[model samples]
Structure formats: structure tokens, C-alpha cells
Target chain A: MANSASGESIIRRFITIISAFDDKHTSMSVAELGRRTGLPVTTTYRLVDELLLERLLERDPKGNIQLGTRMWELASRGSKTLGLREAALPFMEDVQSVVQHSTTLGVLDSDEVLYIERLGSTSTIVDITKIAGRLPVHATSSGMVLLAHSPSAYQDMILSRPLTKYTETTLTDPAALRRHLAEIRQRGFAAMPGVIVPESSGIAVPVYGSDSTVVAALSVVVPRDEENTAARVPVLMTAARGISRALGWRGKLKGTLRQSH
Target chain B: MANSASGESIIRRFITIISAFDDKHTSMSVAELGRRTGLPVTTTYRLVDELLLERLLERDPKGNIQLGTRMWELASRGSKTLGLREAALPFMEDVQSVVQHSTTLGVLDSDEVLYIERLGSTSTIVDITKIAGRLPVHATSSGMVLLAHSPSAYQDMILSRPLTKYTETTLTDPAALRRHLAEIRQRGFAAMPGVIVPESSGIAVPVYGSDSTVVAALSVVVPRDEENTAARVPVLMTAARGISRALGWRGKLKGTLRQSH
Candidate 1:
């Protein structure tokens, strides 16, 4: 809770340091870390020293600091993300084996779709989804499925924002997107062709929790020209249901499914 | 890095709060967190407030706090664990599909086998492996494979310690375990039947990184009575090589394999 002279808390500074590491930028020197985090040299070194001492960060053999295995362990040991990923993996594997493409399980996090687990070959399609990677809510089938099941207020809040148009098919208009969300809800799935990429299509279905609330989006990426919506949707829906069941979700009664604005 | 009156840094306290949650206790009230963490009530409340402010922890509708999605994202985005898991998952899926058992990817962390990714039917076997769960280095097939590939000094350090005897079949003797490690290295896999759990057996092979270093242990847990080491070891070795190649490992040249300890 202690605030630095610049009015930023130690936690915020810590977050800045941790956020500097991504898939491509996994390790760097303390000086580079300070520059990336915009923290003072002394402050960065001090914080890095603390984090290293706590085993939250580690120095590679090359002496560049990287996120430590301990940090991952601490975050994952009690994480709901890990729980959901574990429950969905077998079903995802089933889907991947059948579909022969990338299958991903994503959840709504910080207003974006954060992919938690993915399987299948990377060479199959132009799939950009990665574990812990985020994509725009409007440009992804997984995002649309999650948004379609979200509360009307949250949906409105998301749609009111300026949406990024990633491709020719990406719907950026709020009204158009709302209509798409309605269709997605009514159809019980979202199939977007070339919304994020030009050569691939994403089909996603809602995976529910014990309370019958949509907890994640189970999705698959396939070649855009080979977009077998009707065929792929069934496989996705089946796998989603299995994952939902694994999460303690009983099948919804015939009429209990709710619609959003 | 400042230590409190108790001589513990805030980072240590942060770890304590996160460590309080596990597979069973994913959420808890601040009061209960204080009790579990053994921190003073005021300190717990203060730290909890800070964590919640940063979205490192989240409050549920029932007022119970859980590890936030941000924590998972921050921990995962720059993690080598995620990178390793991603690389090994597809191959592990292939192994799991064929083996029809629990496939796990483990790495040496804190002198134990920390399972980072696992797949398969939990109902099929008495598998103690959970994502983010730890097992003693000597009691697990994955751990033994990792230990066998590690430097002799590190192996000596581990074998010199008092190891827990989890089952009657668990080899705790330094000299005997050393011989077994040698055999595992030569045989190219470890098939430990009833080493940790009497109802289950573990089969493991080493996964190599780009530099040809033993990066992880890929394993499967099956029923002890159905231990098919002859058929399973080859499958594991094949998949481990696939995972290693994905991690940028060039093919191992003939006669390059070295024994440790």
C-alpha cells in the first residue's frame, strides 16, 4: 500500500515490471526492464532485487531476468483459470482430434478474450490465439460468444466503445454488432469468417458453469474457404457441452436459456 | 524491499496471501485469509485491500476473495512455463489419446516436480498430478527423469537428503536410486510402478530445449496393474522428441547422450 514519491503504489510498479514480459519479451537485463517499465534505474534495480529474492523473477544463465517458475506456481496453484483449463482440456482434445485444427478455450477477462488453453497444430490455420494472449472482443468468435451471453449492461458498455476493425468482415458498427450478438445468442454459437484474419474462420460456442452462466467460449479455427459452419458448429457445441458438464453444468432445461439486449 | 517489524518483506507477505488459496480453497474472506496466512489481522486487511485495488485479487458476489484473472495473465504472459506447456501440449495430447491415461508435462521447480500441464480422464486412474501441484523429486517418474538428466552435483545434493518413502516400492537408498537413474538414462525412460500411489504407475521421458538441455519431463500416469512399459516408452520418447523439436532442439547427434551422476 506504500506509495512512491510519484504517487504510484509499489504494487503498480510491480505490475509494470511483470507486464514487461510477454511471449516475445520473456527475458531482459535490469536496465532494459527499467526502460520498458519507465521506472527509475535505482527503483527498478531495488524492485527487481526484491522480486528476485522472493523468487518471483529469476536471472537466466545469461543474467537476464525472466519471470520465475515460482511466480507461475504461485499464480496457478489456486487459479480458477487452471481449474477451467483442466476441465475443458479433454473435451478440447476430442474436438481438436476431430476438427484437425486449433481448438481454444477463452474467457472474458479485462474486457478482452483471454485464451486459456489451445491445442492442435500451429501450421493448420492462421490462428493467432495463444495461451494467455488477448484479442479484441469484436474481432473474435470467442469474444462474441462471451459477449452474447454477458448481461445487457455489460454488452452495451462493450459495444459503446470504438471497436477495432481487423479485417473486411469485422463488424465495427455498434448496431450491426448488437444484431450479430443477438443472432449468436439465438443460434447458440458464433461463426466469424475472416473477422480477425483474412484466411481463417473462428467458430465458438458458450461453455457454461454449474450456475448455467457462460464461463468461457470453446472455439476452433479452420481455413476460411473451408468454413463448414453447420458441420463445425455441432462439433463445437458437443465439446462445449461436455466441458460444461465437466464443470458441473447440467444441460439447460428446454426453456431456461436467457437472452440479452 | 523494506522489511516490516517482523523482518518479512511485503513480497513475502504477498506470497503468503496467494499461497493460502489452493485447489480446494480458491476463495476466502479476508478474515479467513488472515487466519490461514497467520498474518496480523490489520496487515492482512491492508494487503488484501492493496491486492484488490490492483485487481490481483477479486471479490465475489458472496464477498469471498479469489485470485484475480489479472494475476494469471501477468504470471502467464511472460512465463517460460506457458511457452513449454504450449510446445508440449499437442504432442502430449497425441500421447494421451493413444495412452488413454493422464499425460503430464512437468519441470523441476524448487527441487520438486511441478506439473504445469496435464490432460486425460481423471476418473481412469488415481493420479495425484494436478496443474501447479508438486511432488517430491524422488517419488515421481517425471522427477527421476529430470534428476537423471541434471548435473551430478545437483543429483548428489538431492540424493544426500532424507527422501520421503511414499510407498514400499519407492527407492530411497542413494546408491540404489543412483543405479536406477543410470538405467533410466540408458533405457530412455522411467517406468515407476506404485512409486507414489499404489493404484497408479508413471512413465516419463525427458523433453529437451533448444540448447539440448533437459527442459522438462513428459509423463503419463496409468493403472499400476496395467503398466505397459514396453509399449508406452516408445510413444513417450517419440512425443518427447516432437516437443523438443518444437522447442528448437536440433536432432540429437549419435553418441552425444551423456550420463549424469
Candidate 2:
């Protein structure tokens, strides 16, 4: 490898350029990319050209560059996300078919609930989560399940950190959140009502892995006023267990996030 | 933009580094990455270090790095794949449930079909195609379906380029392949039996986009001996149409791979 500071610096800048394209900023002009990455405009354009040549980032007919199918190809293949999502899909679809609501699989990532997969009917609860997207662990049911089953170090990390409040009902108090997480462990699920949004309840349970570690969370978002959503619990648990079995996690399974666990 | 040769050169190396991660090589040591990227080992290591710091790549317990959740997050959020997959999922699932094999959604990229999604069942046809993987346009059913409905420019581009044969049955002759593509257009679907492997067959239908252009190909991999797999054509056609409708394509749709005059 080159020891040239310049070579290393360019790689850092390139990563920044790549990272600049997130959920809100999928396509960007060369100038915009330079600005976002804090690289010189000329450098940005040159890198953009190289990326385009390699098909890692593609320019549309309009000339705005977006994540190339090749970039997606390179990043996505042979990934834990791919393997986990494959095993989780059938069961997730089953839950979505029955519940007709937002059914999701999430894992603990940096103390937040990173949703690995989600499916819901059009008429069901409007969810703010996306696949490969993250939401606060203490503020969502899926988060709670992961948080509850996670090592104490993770909870301490989150509790010690600043908690952003999304709704009035979000448990910002560390003691309260700790108790709630404990309750979730005891109840085998987390029922978070009015935590992330008004009139919505997120119910999530642990998805175990081969080592019996809580590796993921399976959850559904329902209307806060709905009492019938409880019947969905057994179905979700069964589906979660099925995914665990597929992954060869047959221990006194705790929970497994479908991906990146 | 300044035309700094140094700037251009560095950016070029960066793309090379990212491109090195593929289905066949998901994780590699910095020395290995340097060898693949043709960059200096020190350069690869230093840049990879920065990327590691940014969470673009995470080190495994073995101290080797793999693509990180951040990469997946940035690639997935608000990307076309999200909308495209969301639109195609129900149909893809529908196809998989009945076919109980490898169901996939692929789009044309760089004169090849890049599979963005794949759902593989236990009894699925064994193939090397994985999610975020590519196959030659003339050798794959999905690629053929996409190419059959594509513009003349794409046709000419592929024709001018040498067609790499994957199997003995693959149509490598330009004239024969052109005719094969035309028939796929005529039939409105592509039945590529033994095109890739002897024991498997691929059936694909074109999936349309907002302007009614064939933007994708939805296909299934089934056992070669299963004549009943032909029944999957109607199911796939229906699913393709559903996805196309969702993508804003509409008409008294002819649900086939053919180009209408």
C-alpha cells in the first residue's frame, strides 16, 4: 500500500463523497458532491468521472450522479443482510399478509434499532422506518426488544447518551426506560404506545440466534386504539422463530436481528 | 474545477478500491485490497482506516473489514431500488410462493442484467446468480427480456461487443442472438432453457416503468424437467404487470416481452 499522505487523503475524500448520497440526497451535481465531501471541486469531478468509469456511481441522462447498480452490487452481495433477509422474507410476508400492518425486523446497531426488513399493506399504519434505516432504540418497540435483550453495555451507552424526544410519551427518563426494558424481557415483547408517534403502538419481540443471543427484533406497528393487534403476537413470534430456525439458531434462543447481527 | 492530475489520479484509485469488493470477494486484507486495487499497500491501509473511522467499513473479530451498515444505509435509503423493490416485492413473493424456487428482479446495467433482489427457496434451481450480481444479456432470461424490449442503441452496443458464452446453449452468434431476442419480443417472454446451466431453466418477463419502457425483468429459476413451470409465466406476467402499474405504466397492457409496433 502507498504511504503517500496524498493517496490516503484522496481515499478519505472519496468515502465522504460516497457517504454524501444518503436517503435525502441520492443524486448530486459534481459541485454539490465536492461541497458535501469538502473536497476541491476539481478533485470531486475527477473522482466522479473515475467512479462513473468503474460503474460504481452512475450519471443519469440528466447528468446527476447516483449510487450505481455496480456500487450496490459490490456492497450488497454475499452480505449478512442478504442472507438474513432471505430467511426472514417468507415469515415477514406471512406476518404482513395477516396483520396488514408494518411488520419489521431490526437489530441493535450503535444502540439504535437498525431496521433490516419491513413490509406492510398500503392501508396499514404509516411507518417512518425503511430497510437499512435506523430509529432510536428507546423510542420504538423494535428498539426496545433489541435494547432489552442486548448487553448492559449497550443500554448504558444509550442511557448515558442524549435521548432525542419524538413524542410526549417517549420514555426519556433512563430509570423509566430501564424498567420498561426489563418489563419487555419479562413479557417476551415490548408494547410501546405513543412513543414514536401519536395514536400508534409498536409491539416487538426478540429474535434469537444460534448462540441464544438476542440478535434481532421482530415487530409490528399498529394503531394505538386497536386492541385486536394483540392476536398478531403469536403469529409474529412464530415467524421470528421460523427465521431463527432457518439461520440454524436452535438454542434456548434469545433473539437475532435478521441482518448485521 | 481545477484540472489537477494529482486529484484525478487519487479519485481513480478510490473507485478502484471500492470496486474491489464484490460477490466473490466480500472481505480482504489491506494487502490483498492493495493488490486488487493496484494501489500501494500503505495507501489502501490508510484510506481503509479512514473509511473504518467513518463506519463505511467495519472490522470483524478477525480484524478484516467488511462492508458496513452505513454503506447499506446510504445505498438503500431513498434510492430507486427501494421504490422499485417495494413495487416488485409482492409480485416477486407471489411468484416465489407458488414457484418455490429462485425468484428475482433484475434491471439492465452496463449491457448486462444486474439482479437487485433474489428470493431463493430450498428446492430452488442451483445457480451462481446472487443478489447484486450480473449476468450477460444474451445468456440470461431476465437479461434477454430486458434487451429484447430495449432501444436499438443498446442492441447495437451489445452486438458490437463480443458476446461471451456462458454455456454451449448460449447464443454467441450475433445473428442467432438477434433472432433469439426478436423472438423473445414476439413471444412477450423469454424461455431460456439450458442457457446458463443444463439442469435449470429460466423464464422471464419484462417489467415496465413510468413511461411504459421495459425498465426491468422479473424472472424465476426452476428445474429443467418441470414442464409445469410454464404455468409460472402467467403468474410472472401478472406480477410484472402489477409492478409496472405501480411504477406508473398503464394501458390495455400486453403482458409480454415483445415490442409492439
Candidate 3:
């Protein structure tokens, strides 16, 4: 297993090093990286040297190490994320243009809603979603749509835990949440006003894969006070169907029994 | 340095394993992976075990291993590519909508053009470009714009090599290419007709970064016989300026005195 003195595998340490970086902390000194990763100085330096030699990590103009283009290429060249994003981008553009707000594509990953692609006016909205960013599965419309389509057992497990309430309107009770999930599935989409942010509301519909399983949530974020927010649901549903068809989904949707043709 | 028995560091081996997968070859058996990476079977098995432990690689339902979501998340969460794509996507969509062709954003990486974002009709044109794909610097319009902005020393070094002639229009002669670069710099754009492929042509303009340096090329691909291709240059240039402004570019471009506002 190649365990070090602390009985941790080299792979574990590698994850620790890479996970220390994020959108906010894209680059840092080696000493700071060691502190964030909680590794010994010697081990940190040794591993970082090896990573740099392979160009998985690169030195910035300021001499601080950051993620390398090579690493992104290696990870993305064959990723399913790329294929999904490619299938969804054109349709997302249509939604964004018509909605005139933020359009995002998210998927359920490890019990959290991970945003894979987003498009919209960057500075004109109170939207906080970012590509590659994560949010709790109970606090966003995208998350609710995904959860509503997941297996009942899995949904129960997720709801069994305490959910964080980001706003006064966020539903934290397990029974109330279950009823809401049922409503979402029945309506063929989820619309939550001020669930996560009081100034923005999210509306999301499920995107399907070739196997007729829910693969992603196609959503848009608009001003909470926009009284006609419900009118935007057809635009989102149409775009979601387009994306689903692009992914080779041929069967009718589970609840709506709707076909793209 | 943690060098393995073959005198290569573990990091190098890690890269070999990851690089073995690409857009075409996403998953395979361990033995197939060993063959693709040119590594010993034992080393491949051991290293793959460690990688699976860290969730950097995963086994699909059919028992084939492929790159993991965690690997993609780690690489993308803090990538400079993400930032550039975010700044360029909205404007790229506008260009794509107007041109009704394939619009792409690419950056010069390792002396080649690497496309980071692409949009528009995917099936109507003979475009060979894909996100995460690379093309020769001398055979692409985007490459020409990047080369025109690069330091003369770097440009000279690239032109000194034997360039591949992908099509009859590809410029392989160093002196001819140098003259073309000068023209691209003077005109603030590069248009290559059937340079790499016979059926399509590319037109590109340079996008700037915060420090007012050329950081990317925004290009559109159109049918080679379309004489109106020149008419699209203004749209590309306008979108490029918007992207440059979004990146915080304020100073005048090196060759052109035009500003976005």
C-alpha cells in the first residue's frame, strides 16, 4: 500500500495536497500549502518537488505553486463531465438568453449538488452558484429536483440527517421535506423562492440520460420578486428536454410522460 | 525523489497512467492500461490500487477502470482555465449566435493551441476542434493570433522547426509565416482559409488578460467557400474585446489602439 511512517498511503497524502486548493485559494507558498494540508515540511517539499517535475503542479509568476494546465488536460480529456457539459451548453445558452438570468446545470454527487456548468449575467444578479461549486442537497432547487428523482431509500437516508436552514423559508423538517419532494416529482419540476438566498429564486427540471435515468438538473436563478417566475418553467422544461435528447434519452419522462418528438 | 525501480519517479508513473486516457480511450482493463502506458503489469496493478483507494480512479459497473470525478474536481476547482472560460463564455455565445458557426476560445499551451471553450452548430461544419484538443500552432487561426502577440524570440523558435503541412494552404516556410504574423499583428486579426482542413476556414482575434497580455484567441470556423467570412471579423473582435474587458484589461492592445468601450 506504500504507507508512510504515519500509516497513511501516499495516495491519501496526495489527495490532501490537491484538496488544499480551491477557487478562493488557487495558489499558495509551499509552506502555506504544507500548513493547509497538515503534512510534515519534509514530506510536503518532497512530494511537491515530484509533482512539479511531472508538471501536475506549476510555479506561478510569483513563484507560488498552483494547478497546472497539464493536470486539467489530463483530468478533462476523458471525463464524463466534459461530455455532459458539451451536451448541455447549447441548451443552457437558450435558457439563459430567454430567462435573462443565471442558468446552471447541476448533478447529485456524493450527496451534494455539484454545479457542472453555469451561464448568465455575472454581476447583475445575487446568484452564488459557480461551476465546480457545491451546495447542500436540501437548500437549492437543483438539489431538490435531483433528490426527487433519486431512489426512495437514498432520499430517506439523506433526509434522515439534519439539514441546514439557509433562509427562513428553507424546509428542514423531514416530513415536510418528503411531502415537498413528492410535490416536486408530481409537478415535473422544482421551484424554490428564497430557499438559499432571500433575493433569488431557483427553478429546475430533471435532465435524463440514454438509460432513462435522471442525470442532471437544468435550472435558472431569477429575482425572487419576479411574479412571472412560473412562466419561465416552460422554457426551462423545453431546454431540459433538448439536453436530455442530446444525451440520447428516448423514453418518456417518469412523471410527465412527455416525449421530445 | 521516490524513484521507482525503473529510475522514474512515482509522480511520473502517475502521470503516465492518467495520460493513457483521452477523449477516445476513456476506460480499459488494467492490462490494457499497462499496455497503453508502457508500464509493467505489476506496477500498473499496484499503482491503480493506490489510485482507486484515493478515488482518483474508479471502476465502472462493467469492471473497467476510468478517470474519477474526484480527479476532475481537483483539477478544475482551482484551474486558471475555469476563470478564463467563465469570463469568455457569455461573449462567445453572442458571437456564436450571430455567426451561426462554431465559435471557440483557445489558449497557447506548450507551443500549441489548446481549445478551452467552444459553441455553435456542432454538426453543420467540418470543424476538427474540440474542448481539451490541441492543434499545431501554424495550422490554426487561433495559433496565428497567439503567435502574433508572443515575443519575437518565442515566435522565431517555433517557426525554426519543420512545420507540418496539414493542407495545401498551411504555411510551412518560416519567412512566409513570419510575414503572415506581421500582417496579423497589424490588422488585429488572423483569417486562414482551409489551412488545416479543406472544407472549412478559421478567423481569430486575440483576447487580453488583466496585465494587458494576449492570453487567448477567440475564433469562429466557417465554410471555406464563404466569401462573407471577412464580414464576421468585426463580431469576433467585438466579442474578444468584451472578454478582454471582463478579464480586467485596460491598456491599449500592443498593435491596435482600439478599446472595448
Candidate 4:
């Protein structure tokens, strides 16, 4: 209803302002924010003022603006992700304890994998996943597991797009990717070695929700040379099952039963 | 810039809409949302439409609207809370393992204790702390530790307010609380027995940031009957130091050093 002269809604401009900040640029001066968001200086100031009034944005002692704790609280208090994260954390810890590597819980969002919860390790693995960070759905084991369980039409939609070959082993050909997705569904997990990063391998299994539908992927990142799938997959599978049960998943429907080897 | 007929800005209305949903009411019908937010039907619908366009809100299969994953991602991606949470989690896990009870990391926000990261245990200690949930500053050990470390002006402002006595042990007298704050500052920890929930006790230690400023509180909840502060405080203090170190905190300032008992 509140469209600017550019025909963009206020919400769009708000999103733009918030999106200007990332992990690298957690705080910035108003002038820098205006430049980064590409909004008119006056518009940026006005929106920032309103946001500050509501404590949706705050200024540090150095007068640089950053996202407010209120924003995080409001977003988290009612978020479905919170419930999923709470349900998965304990089991993810168990997996992390055993794997002694980075363990992450990710969901398919916006055609990418959004890591919601990640327990990092002291290991020297070259894992790049960060909480709230995104990765291509075709280049990681978690993404592959999520994509394999998604509806076929959605898979087709993703496969139709040009995929980036991040590493030598990354599958970019749609036919090959489709075959791989089918195999992942059949095997109930995905183990991709050096697909995104040359030094790390990701092993992931699907986590089901109350409806027995795949809701997330619980995964571990280990050294590429140590792709011990037999030892790792069972740990992930067991933890994923625990998470699924915590989320009220009553087990798979009879006809859709899948086995993990 | 976009103020409604009642003179509330679009951002305020947006906050109202989002705040209507919470852990207990994660999703709701549009009409119910309008009623809950107390915004006009038309305004609610329009804002909901815009928010849906940005994927800041999503509808469940039952046509009920809830906070979107994008909202959580946006709030988390650049949030200071995320970094603090990440730094605290590994140590929080260790504390949880030993305490075998709920461990929480909270920051003082809007004059209350807002728990950012909590590692829940299987113990039946009656912990009321939830991630993103808030409790009054006077009754929570996390809140007291935070308040104790705060600037004198801020502490005076809080002390001037009419404090709620949640339980018989909750200190509502400004003079008593001020004295208690001094004790907490001197002792380097705050342990309140059944101050909020009658059955649970909270032992909290201040977690410092790089500047040696207390940025958050690391605490554990235990049964009131077993108020083992001697054993619990050291574990919390150890974990808090680890978290502080992870946050780049070196140690206390030379002249302002305090001892933990």
C-alpha cells in the first residue's frame, strides 16, 4: 500500500536495507548503508530512523548501525525453524560427538540449502557451511538429500537451470544428476566427496516431520580422503531418526518405506 | 515514512503483525491474525500480502500464516546474537553435559533477559527458559548478572522501576536489589534460588566480549532443593570464560578485577 515513486513497496525497501548487512558487514555507518543498499540517502535515513525507534535497528557506541536483538527475537520466537532446530539440536549433538566433525541441520529454501543449526568442530576440515548461509542444492550432500526427497516437479525445475560445477566431481549434467537423486532416494542418504570443496566430503540423511515427509537434512562434513560411509552413514541415520521422532514423525508410511545401507 | 491513519509507521504495523504469532500460536488464519494484531482488516491483509511477496511470511497447508524461514535467516545472517551463540554453544554443551540440566546463554534486551541459546537437558528441573523467550531482570540470575555488570545509570533506571516479585525469594525492594547487585559484581557471579519458578534455581556468570564488557550471561537451572552453588558456579564460570575467550575477551581490566567463589 505504501509504494515509493519507484513503485516499490515500503516492505521491499525495508528488505533492501536489512539485506545490506551480512556477516562480513555486520555494522556500518548510515552513509555506507545508503551506498550499500543503493537507496536515496534521505530515504535511507528516514527508514533507519523508524527502524531505530522500534529497536529493529541499533547503533553501536561507534554510531554504526546493526540489526537489533529485537529483530532476531521476533523472528525466532514464532518461527517454524525454531521448533525444528530445538528438535534437532540434541540429536545433532550426539552425531557431532560421534563424528567429531562439523554437523549441520539444513532445510531446502529458495532453491538452495539454508543451514539452520551448525555445531562446528576443531578439526582441520575445509567445511564452509555457516548458520543461515546458503549453498547450491546440487553441490552438497545435504542439498542432494533434500532435493532427492522433494517433489519430482520441483526437481525438474531445479535441474532445468544451469548448474555451476564447483569441483571436478560436481554433477552438472541434468541426466546424471537425476540418476544420482534417484539413487539417493533409494539409499536414503547422500554421500558426496569433494563436490563443493576439494578437501571435504559431506554425508547427509533426511529428517522427517510429523507427516513423515522429509523436512530437513542432518549432515556431517569430514575429510575427503576419509569417506568412511559405512561408519558415518549409520551414525547420521540414527541421529536423523531421533530428530524425526522428536518432531513427532511416527515413522514412514508403509508404501514409501526406504532403507539406508 | 509510511504512517497509517492512526499515525503508526508501516514498520510498526509490520511488527504488530509478526508479534501476533508466537511459540504457542505459530500459525493462524488471516482473520485471526487481524484480530490478534488489533490492526484493521484491510491494513493487515495488505501488509500480509506484501510480506508474503517478500517471503517474510508463509502459509501452511491449512491456509494459516506463520513467520517464514527467510525472516529467521535474515535476522540471523548478520546478527550479533548468532556470533555470540556460536561461541557459546560448544561450551554450553560441555556445561549441559556436566550439569545434566538446562543451560542458557542470555543477553539483556529491552530491560529483560532474552535467552539466545539454550541447551536443554532431560532433567526435570522446571526450567522456564526458552530460546527467544524473556524473563524479568530482577528475578532471573541471568538478568541479575547482566544488570549487575551494566553501567550505574542503567542499573539505577532499572532499580527505579517497580519490580515484580515472581516468587517469595525474588527481590523487589530497590535497596535490597541494589545491594545484591553490588554483591554480584563483587562475587563475579549471581545465584538466585527459586527467584522466578519456585522449584528451580539459577546460577549465572557474566560472559564478556572482546572489550571486557559483560555482553551476556551464561547460566544453569537446577532444582531448588539441590542448590549446589559451590559445584555449579565453577562449572558455569569455566564455561563462561571459555565463551568469553571465544568472543575474543582477554580478561577483566586490571583495576576492576573481581573473584568468583
Winning model by lDDT: 4
lDDT of 2 at B55: 77
Give the TM-score ranking, best first: 4, 1, 3, 2
Give the distance in Å from residue A223's predicted Cα in candidate 3 to where it truly belongs. Answer: 1.8
DockQ of 4: 0.90
Give the TM-score of chain B in candidate 1. Answer: 0.96
Write down the C-alpha DockQ for each prediction. Answer: 0.83, 0.48, 0.74, 0.90
Query: iRMS for all predictions?
Result: 0.8, 2.6, 1.0, 0.5
Tell me the number of clashing residue pairs for each predicted model. Answer: 0, 22, 0, 0
lDDT of 1 by residue, B110-160 (tens): 779999988876788899898899999999999999999999999999999
Tell me the lDDT of model 2 at A159. 92
Give model 4's TM-score versus the native structure.
0.97
Report the lDDT tens digits of candidate 1 across residue range A212-236: 9999999999999993556888788
Among all candidates shown, the one with the greatest DockQ: 4
Score every model by TM-score.
0.95, 0.88, 0.94, 0.97
Name the docking class for model 2: acceptable
Q: How far out, in Å, is residue A132 in model 4?
A: 0.2
Which is the better candidate, 1 or 2, if ranked by TM-score? Answer: 1
lDDT for each residue of candidate 2 in B20-119, tens digit (9 for 90 to 100): 7765676777788888767766667877887788677777656877777767766676467777888898788888888888889999988788888888
Q: What's the TM-score of chain A alone for every prediction?
A: 0.96, 0.90, 0.96, 0.96
What TM value does chain A in model 2 reach?
0.90
lDDT (0-100) at residue B170 of candidate 1?
Answer: 94
